[model samples]
Target chain A: MSVNISKPSFQPYTGEKARISRAFDYLILVLALFLFIGSFHLHFALTVGDWDFWVDWKDRQWWPLVTPLMGITFPAAVQAVLWEKFRLPFGATLCVTALLIGTWVARIFAYHLWNYFPINMVLPATMLPGALVLDVILMLSNSLTVTAIFGGAAFALLFYPSNWPIFGMFHVPVEYGNGQLTVADLFGFEYIRTGMPEYLRIIERGTLRTYGQYATPLSAFCSALLCSLMYTLWWYIGKWFATVRYLNKI
Target chain B: MATTSEQLPVSLESDSKIPWYLQDLPLYLKGFGILTVIYIGLRLYQGAFAVASGLDSSEPAFEQYWMQLFYVELAVIAVFVTSVWGYLWFSRDRNLDQLSPKDEIRRYFTLTMWISIYTFAVYWAGSYFAEQDNSWHQVAIRDTPFTANHIIEFYFNFPLYIILGGSAWLYARTRLPLYAKGISLPLTLAVVGPFMILVSVGFNEWGHTFWFREEFFAAPIHWGFVIGVWFALGVGGILLQAVSRLIELLDMLEEAP
Candidate 1:
């Protein structure tokens, strides 16, 4: 019989370093505390259709573009802290994982477990794999600016395809009461009963063949571009957060 | 039958001036014990109530039963405060420099357990409860952003995780010597990214009020949240590095003959 026992190694540190570390720790703590509190209420609002309740503007063109842009802030700031200071390659991955886990878990509990809504009708936004891919690319490159330029573009470009597998089924065309509309149109038809009329869907009808029936390509391109721009700005933010020396300290 | 004293190792019974209890008392009797007991008890009580109420099919219990659960959760948090303070007080003497190899290992295990519990508690608060009502699905009309679901999800759940994420960072920074010297970027990302997302929840809620009445994949109002979500990648990088360093430290310790 073999007994596997391990000893622990303890490192000594100076009091000054400890104090500085404590200050950083407090800053991190303050930020984390804010995140924990904010996500709870945000999920509820999204579920209840508070922020995303406008039907007229809810088109493929703008929705995907904006959601990712807003979401990019965390990853950018986090990356600043991780990449610049710690040379950690998984900042995006961790943040994405937490968000996906939190979002999906919330959706499942709210929709399935809590009977908040039918899963088929309303699902949580899917962005985890894209986040993972971005992190992997950043890890391989080890360059924040390059990652921002390429990874950000990739993040946007990948959104449609990543979500297409799920949302594609809803993209199919359907005729409701003689009005030929895509499944996306019927989404608003069944849910989202606001002041906006039903005829406002940005889909191609039999009479109008100007734009193709699909809008995903254009939407994805715009999203990718926006993501690229966001990535560039956020890279700087990441660097800022990684800054160890404070003005007061100087 | 020979000398029983010969069985003892030279280091085992050799006494320094410091009393053993004084050396290790902080390790075990930290206030965390009582807090843990109270939190567990409250959680159990809430779970039991939910089960019992769910079993009944007769009454149309109020629509906001889920919201009521928040109070029970608050009670659990109150208990956590006690636990944290208690642990801090009891572990004062067991600082990193003073601990023996055995005690150091024990403290690491204890810290891991505390963090794990904290993580679980955060998930429950930030994700689980916010989605409880399903009030949005039930309603036929789209009202203000503060409709009950938004209130719970944006205002309630998002903040809870931010708090947890921040506390976790604080814990690693203040208490652990390894994390004290150099800033752990991944840990910072992990904490900070989530916090930004939490703030974006407000923008997300307000956006829905002005526009985005329907599910559009791309909306300018939602751009803020998408940007926030993207930051998670940076955070992921940092977490991997931190964990790797921890593992390396562990391995180094284990390799020493």
Candidate 2:
């Protein structure tokens, strides 16, 4: 909270020129704001872009585990900085919004214009309750440790269930070439991936073979435990970032 | 009103002790220029490599191109890392306890510039090219260690971050006394975390080989990378340490009470 890092206090403008200058500054500020947030969006999408890209990868076992594991990092970092530095609690919202914008940009430029992939296939799943829960927990507790433990669990556990509504359509069973196929599996067959053959996919292989419907929940639970750990470690990261010092050497 | 470089809105003066270039030349511009060259070069390299490798969608034609590029990038990265790191260690300040506050402030500017470049580099690596993987991988088959996506994203973009992050961390350790206090934890994490993504590349290569050469962005192997870049969060602490001191120094230049 040094003077420069904190917002500079400005007095009311008395002159018309000063007023015009301030207006221009606001306009420029708006532009920079979009660009900065746009970067956040791009960065956020990198975490889950692959999961959303292919139909074959959206199986019960790996998809749930992989998505939440990488997805939560952005929120954890953003929450750490915004809450600790500015006492603001909009990290969750910012994360989700940034991600939406990033994926929208991706689908628009990459899928829509370049390849003309279907929007339904390219659209990323919304975080839904998970993001909101993190913000609420942080707002209530006001302690990074508490937020990490409870908030992180909520983020992970909810990720699979929250996204189920979106991916459920693809999972619905439909008749195909030799036997029954889920819409997801059929999409994989229909789309011609010259580089990605059917043999390359590793879906529903391990616990999925043994546990059927119960596999995703197990993944979700494991995700919560790891998410809690990542959040706790990253919280210290936030506190460490707040350190402002000039040392005299080791 | 200050206008000239000599009268710049900075309180500290080196008294010709610090080099003229550090004092006169703008730090941000130096960083900006170098990063621009690297970025444009990378784009050119990727474009050319894609064509050369058959990443232009002709799956069968490009089989050998990616594997060869991967090995070459790996070798180049090894040399690049060693040379830059050796330069930093060899050129470190012999006596940190004797440096002036002015020098410290000047060094901080350089460090900030390094980070500014590092931030964008991370964006290009972790997000832009990383996301670009979806477009390319979904469109092609990934049979080798170097897929079209991996050639640009992992080999080119990821290595750029290592260079930028390593340089920034080295600059701080060699010049700043603050880092002498057992290596600033945030700074270490800032450097080490992204550096871990390099470790993750091992996981990525192994996973691709042992398992199918599939492209799933959120696979267990890939988590290390995305999380590694998330360590860029540590830049927060580095900023706090710099921005406050910078403001105080600027106030001094203004002769404010």
Expressed as tens digits, the lDDT of each residue in A171-231 for candidate 1 is 6778899999776566556754343445534333343233555565666777778887888
For B132-223, candidate 1 gives per-residue lDDT tens digits of: 43323233233445333443445544554455455555555555555555566655654575567657667766665665454332335555
Please report, as a residue range, the 10-residue window in candidate 1 chain A with the lowest summed lDDT.
Answer: A241-250
List residue ranges in candidate 1 displaced over 4 A.
A1-58, A71-101, A128-141, A191-216, A242-250, B1-76, B86-91, B94-116, B131-257
Give the DockQ of candidate 2. Answer: 0.21
Q: Which stretches of candidate 2 lie over 4 Å from their true place?
A: A1-50, A55-66, A95-119, A144-175, A178-183, A194-250, B1-110, B134-147, B173-182, B199-203, B221-227, B243-257
lDDT of 2 by residue, A166-186 (tens): 788888898876799888777
Whole-model lDDT for model 1 versus the true structure?
0.51
Each prediction's whole-model lDDT (CA): 0.51, 0.65
> How do the residues B24-73 of candidate 2 rate in per-residue lDDT, one tens digit apiece?
23555565577668656655555566645545434555645655666777
Model 2 Cα shift for residue A108 (angstroms): 5.5
